[model samples]
Target: MSALLEADALHLRFGAVRALDDVAVSIWPGEVVAIVGESGSGKSTLLRVLSGQVAPDAGGVRYAGAEVHALGEAQRRRLMCTDWGYVHQNARDGLRMGVSAGGNIGERLMAAGTRHYGAIRDAAAEWMVKVELDPARMDDRPGMFSGGMQQRLQIARCLVTQPKLVFMDEPTGGLDVSVQARLLDLLRRLVGELGLAAFFLTHDIAAARLLAHRILVMRHGRVVEEGLADRVLDDPRHPYTQLLVSSVLAA
Candidate 1:
């Protein structure tokens, strides 16, 4: 499969601390790729660089053959709204707390050029059901919902646009284990059913194992190992990766 997104020779720095160095990666259409590492290992920084949220000091990112940094601000914003989705570690970062749940979902549809009120609401409601949220709660504000519910609402808002690619950062980070498991299951199903290409960043090896087809292991701002998820996680060659896998298994 051709790469839907690609990053080459990425380098970034923050006050003498290297956030990323000589990194290269790609995400194919309908593929789920995870970046796993300990905190401050540059996993999140690489996600930002690839998704156009942050500009790298050096290197380039291309999405569907278009140079991301070369696009105008308006074009980049439009691409994000239309063809790409980003799910932040915190639901609040991706959701509009003041808007009604349905309104939030409808906003994306509207941005995608769906102006009909009835059609917007219908699509929002359908997405709510698909994400396992009750349509009856469509009028409620995100603050009225639980953490898990808010995350689900956020996912619904993003997927309602039917974006070709989605970027997720520590998607289940703050949830309880049970909640995380359920959310992961839901996410796995939705990504498969929609054939969405995803770039997932998480420190949780279990989450990576559950949801990623391929895994990239990072340490100190460099990719230490990468391969099919099961193979890399089960038989990691790098010391950092072996430690990561062992720690998860021992937990």
Candidate 2:
């Protein structure tokens, strides 16, 4: 598989805090890669940078052999809006509370210059079904939905554009255990069926194991270990990775 996204020697700082330090990783087409670490380890920062939401102080981000920052604003917006989908850690950030479900999904199409209401409504309904959201609630506001339903709506909205690359920040975070399992299963199936490349950030070791084709374990803003999921999870080389795996197994 070709490299869909690449980050090299990434460095970022927020005054006295170093958010990322010389971080590097590459995501392949049609694969799911997870970046896992404890809080403040720069996992979320890396996702933000990769998705072009934040610029790094130094280093490079390349998508399909083209520099992300070097692209013009219009071009970046086009690519990120159509070819990429971003799911933030906070589900609320991923949704439009005031709009109906159909409106939320239609927003992506609107950004892509589609104006026909019929087309937008049909596309929205199709995608909502794809994400397992009921078409019956298409007119309901996000606030009217349950937490799990809101997350589902958010996923439906992001994916309506059929993005090639998706950046998911703790996608199953803040959900009940049952909801998390169901969502994880949905993600796994969608990635496999659509051949979508994903870069997901998470703290759940089992979530990583279940969904990621590869794992990048981070500590203190740097990736301490990276490898195939089974190898990394079953036989972690780094001390921190080992500890994480052991703790997950113990729990």
Candidate 3:
């Protein structure tokens, strides 16, 4: 099968800083790929470029047979709303604080032309339960929920539309250890159940190991290592990757 998303020779810069250099990426349907690196390593920048949130200076990206950069503003927005899901590190950024939790998930359905109120509400409630949230809390505002709950709600909102590809940036960031573990477990199960193709951006090797089938290690805006998750982590070839794994071991 052709790649669900494919990019070749990506290069991006932010003035004097090089955010991406000769980067390439590919994800097939139902495949989970993780990008891992330290802060300022361009992990998040690579994700932004692939998801069409940021334009690469010299590169081409194709998603579902369409050239991403060539898409019009309205076309891009429509694709983002209906076919793609992005989970921000901060739930507040991805969520609508002004609306109820159910409303947030239902909004995606509405964008997809689902008009019946009952159907929207029912789908929202079911997703809430799937993400381990209480269905009874559907009417609560995101701000009223705890940080972990809000993150789970954000996930439900993203996944309710059943998008084939999801871009998740540190979904478990800033949560308590127990909460993070619980959230990771929930995410793992949901990804399997939904057969999602996902890009998981994380600094935590363990988290990547738990969710990703393949791993890419980045440093200085370039991918230094790429392979099956187990092979890369177990016998890392690149010096940077070896150091990364050793540092995690030392910790």
TM-score of each: 0.98, 0.96, 0.98
lDDT of 1 by residue, 81-184 (tens): 99999998899999999999999999999998899999999999999999899999999999999999899999999999899999999999999888899899
Positional deviation of 224 in candidate 1, in angstroms? 0.6
On the 0 to 100 scale, the lDDT of residue 25 in model 3 is 94
* Residue-by-residue lDDT tens digits, candidate 3, 155-222: 99999989899999999989998999999999999999999999999988999899999999999999
Against the unseen true structure, what C-alpha lDDT does each candidate score? 0.93, 0.90, 0.94
- Model 2 bad stretches (over 4 Å): 249-251
Predicted structure 2: lDDT: 0.90
Best by lDDT: 3
Q: Is candidate 1 or candidate 2 better by TM-score?
A: 1
Model 1 clash pairs are none
